[model samples]
Target chain A: MTANWAAVLGSCAIAYAIKLSGHLVPHRVLQRPLVRASAALFPVALLSALMAMQTLTTKGAIEVDARIPAMAAAALALRARWPFIAVVAVAAVVAAGVRALGWMS
Target chain B: MTTKPRSVIIRDAISIGIAVGAYAISFGALGTTSGLTVLQTQLLSLLLFSGASQFAVVSIVGAGGNPASAWASSALLGMRNGLYGLRLAPLLGASGWRKPFAAHLTIDESTAMALANDDPADSSHRGARTGFWATGLSVFVFWNTATLLGAVAGSHISDPRVFGLDAAIPAGFAALVAPRLTTSLTRGLALVCAVVAVAVTPSVRPGVPVLIAALIALTTAMKFGEPIPPTTEDVSS
Candidate 1:
């Protein structure tokens, strides 16, 4: 694959722009109730959208497969209050195991 | 300046190390798979170290997109860290060389972990030092090492996705988000954001949807008067 230097530079610039814009906003504005609320809630929206994208999509199509088992494993791990590593391991193993068993082909 | 106990700092560092290391492997693998030279991959990790941004860059490059597009995509994703840095600035009050290092390491996981321990009454400086050093060192070392490994072994692997490797992004986010569920408002906001993000993802760019979700959650929080708790400071080490 050919590396596109222009694209790389552009992407970097855009990323920095987003960050700089946030910083450019005056400190007082940041303390405004609207801004504070958005900051507080932003993580939730970001993570949720992210989680859905990963768990719901299959090769660009909407179809649930091994991810279901993985999510299940994750839930169990959460219930057990396991460490993050343990939770991921459990989910991956369960998902892979189920696939191996032809349960999620 | 009162220094935090070395043990606490070290433990936090180790956790950061493990998390960054594992994620770096994916970054390296993606870099090489997407045609990045080993040097390029390592540089990306060393300099950028932000997974989503790195992923966006490589994925765009892999798809034969223009370098400008690739950079734009990665930059969009990297914007969040700036917000993280702003939030942490007051807490860290870092100056000199520490400022740059802390800024670089200001990712989701580190921010959450650092802020999770909310004890405004205790030593704020100690908390900042522990969080900054732990996260900065961990991401610096582990991310670089893991990326190198991935670059070396990247070509040999048949399918990293088969083992649910792609899930790392979501899993990582989950790790960050799950720990922050201290109140009903936060939980509900998280749920709404996730759902809305997923719904909007296909219609927009990968990172943009998440940003929108963030905005939605932010607005909702404002409307509801939800109390934003300080970071959790008391998780057992």
Candidate 2:
């Protein structure tokens, strides 16, 4: 438990460092095109990677299942411009229902 | 600087609260499912509201990784928030005291809400302030509350996998990523990074694959020299 707390604090500290680094440096220095460009792409890069991991992996293996149904529901939600909550709820319900009904066990 | 209406701030806060609170239910359920004690689950939600990071930590802990490794993986996944703080500084950089709070609120959802406003030129500051406070407080309250609820009642809610709670992460990511698909370069970069990450996930730690994908996307963006599109909406009143 002590180790876990230490790990959590350490992680928070590291996150704080990264955040402070940008502010500590002169604004002019960071305004360079290269720097701005790099910063702009960071979220896209990070999110893409995250999405891949979440969508493609299943218990340490690469396999597809009920995710296909969820993705279809997500597509509909996106097209309809539904709120985030609505989209998530719809996907969960659909996926769950499919699994519960033994359609995709 | 003209002060924004209190009503607007309140509305933003409420909306954020609802959205964040709903998501926290899943977080809490996941925490319990992963075998975390109630206190630990609540603490994770309270301290680390970043969904991806929390998920990584819980997965590692569940898989029997040491605390240090879990923390490292979670921290690596959360590095994107640092980038968000940098982008948000100009808009929300108030005095010294508020800086930390503002930074805390600059997560993915708040940033998107602020950037999605209709009047970016005149209302950017107000939007930023609204987004920051709304998201920060909402996340803080909703996450802790949902975690507590889940911890207490998690057992009754059997078969979280059956409910497809796991899909929340992907759906959330899609919402974030779909908006960025304005340009071919960005779309291409996103595609390549996702494909690469998925392909390599079997071999490496889960977080490491994403980190490598980030690197690949960044390098690709650098080489191609693409411009970021302007804000999708302007919330200037």
Candidate 3:
């Protein structure tokens, strides 16, 4: 298998092991404050980072583009309590419109 | 506590399934655009089976990060699923072969539905079990089916940028994080992490900045010494 495939399978193994550990490990151990805190906040932080990475840069360099407006539109849709799919759609439409207008790409 | 009828549970599960599963289309499209084959994408859904984690992998790879970075980020995101499994373990009380199955199905929606139906006085946990299984199976079927459909269709699209599908990546992450930022502290942390990620991007490799931001956020959270109550179902899964 290629490196990508290996990464995919390795990720799968790690994910499953983590999941099964929750079932197999004692509940008390998992309930510790640090463990719980890590689980709760890690995603919040990682996702925020991921969003910034995707929106603010292209190919590992800082670049401004249509993704900015797309994210703004998505934020509005989320604030309005629009459905998840609609939020994504609004972002896509806004980005497409912006790029089409030659404002950004 | 009163349990809803079994039919209601089934309906709710399927509706939630449909809602959540529809996002798999984005995953499918993004996966292909990131250079993953349709089969590889499908395997991600079937094996990894967690929405945010799968998205992390694709986004990291699409950004030209190395394979190791892609694996670490995705696995880090998948850590939450393990927490969900922790929450469901006592409640679901599965055994033998069923243990693995139940563990795999433990996700935000399943845990939320199960706990919502649980009664402190009811030792049998019948309603909780039903909620867990129904929601889990519903999402599994819908998610896999949607992934297949999206992958097939996305393969034909030559330019994701033209369709704004490229922009959809960040938008999707924003949606995932929005619901979780229920508290002011979490929101602040998110903002800080976003700034940190952008600030460090040029100095570091593609995925390393994200990991750095995450480490900083974790340390900050630890310093605060209170786990943010994950009250809402952060329903990307």
Candidate 4:
């Protein structure tokens, strides 16, 4: 893929602009219930979508591989309240092991 | 405000700062394996500093998607930063040149750190200001340094699947989001979105499916103003 400077610069500007504008926005606007609720729920949805996009998509196809089990291990460890580093370490080991077994490659 | 020693607060801040910094190493590795140049990934970490947005952009671009859509998705995920900025403005009390810099540093970890420092006993004065600046600045330093190491390592290791680094990004996302599934409603909503996103992935462009799944949030938002506590019955019920 081509390095699209425009998109990079545009997105960075938009992100920065959004932050700066948020400060300038009247407290009245922010105090609205709808604004508060939406902001709160937005990340809950976005991050879930991102987890899906990363885990399920591979080489232009939707295929489950080592990432699936690895993530399951991560979920389990997270449920157990493992520190963030341990959670990552468990996931990497599981995924690498699954790959080594030539299960999905 | 409860008279906790300043050393305790500093200890917590340094630990958090280190934790977030170590996490950035994976971003650097994932960024490069996904086809970003070392410079590009480094700058994304250094400038954007928002984990999800950076990951989303590189994920899309690495998957052969257009930059516009990538940017759009990244921008969407980062809109929360605007909300964060609103909350942090008065707390930081930055003026003139420092305003933009403070804005840049407003993120999940920093916000969480500062907000946690709110000791109700001393409502007028708490360690939030200190927590915010300390966490943000420390994260900045550690994150950049770790990124350099990860990117350099990423370059040396081709076929990232060899080390299962391919799985690192998604696993990291799952771990990050897991704690927020405190309520059954959030758990259920996230589960549905994940299922829906995966179902649509084969049929759509790399990023489009995820954006479409976000439409699910709108429906839930309309139906319920707030997530009911886990022990309660469904809001509709």
lDDT of 2 by residue, B1-237 (tens): 344565776577666667667766766766666666667777776666666567666655543446766666565556556655666677665668887666555556666555443245664577556656665677677767876886666545566677786665567667656766777877887888888877887887645665676577558657865467323231111
The runs of at least 3 residues in candidate 3 whose Cα sits more than 4 Å from the true structure, single-residue gaps closed, are: B231-237
Better by DockQ, candidate 4 or 2: 4
lDDT of 1 at B137: 73
Tell me the deviation in Å of residue B135 in model 1.
Answer: 4.1
For residues A4-88, write the lDDT of model 3, one tens digit per residue: 7876787778888888898888878877777677777878889999998899988878999999989999988999988877888
For each candidate, give the interface RMSD after superposing the true interface residues on Cα. 4.6, 3.6, 1.3, 3.0
The residue-by-residue lDDT of candidate 4 on B1-237, one tens digit each, is: 463556776777777778778878888887788888788788887788777787777777777777777777777777667777787777667789988888888777777776667565664435777777777887888888888888878878878877877677777778666766777878888888888887887788766776775677767766777563111111001
- Which ranges of candidate 4 are over 4 A from the true structure? A1-7, B2-7, B119-126, B228-237
User: Where is the poorest 10-residue window by lDDT in model 4 chain B?
Assistant: B228-237
Question: Once superposed on the true structure, which residue ranges of model 1 sit more than 4 Å away at CA?
Answer: A1-26, B1-16, B26-44, B50-84, B87-98, B108-131, B151-154, B166-169, B197-212, B229-237
Q: Give, for candidate 2 chain B, the lowest lDDT window spanning 10 residues.
A: B228-237
Q: Estimate each model's TM-score.
A: 0.70, 0.75, 0.96, 0.89
lDDT of 3 at B70: 78
Can you write out model 2's per-residue Cα lDDT over A3-85, one digit (the tens) per residue?
55655566556555655554444666656665556555655666676666677676556878777688689868977977656
Least well predicted 10-residue stretch by lDDT in candidate 1 chain B? B228-237
The per-residue C-alpha lDDT of model 2 at residue B174 equals 70
DockQ agreement of candidate 3 with the native complex? 0.77
Per-prediction tally of clashes: 29, 8, 0, 0
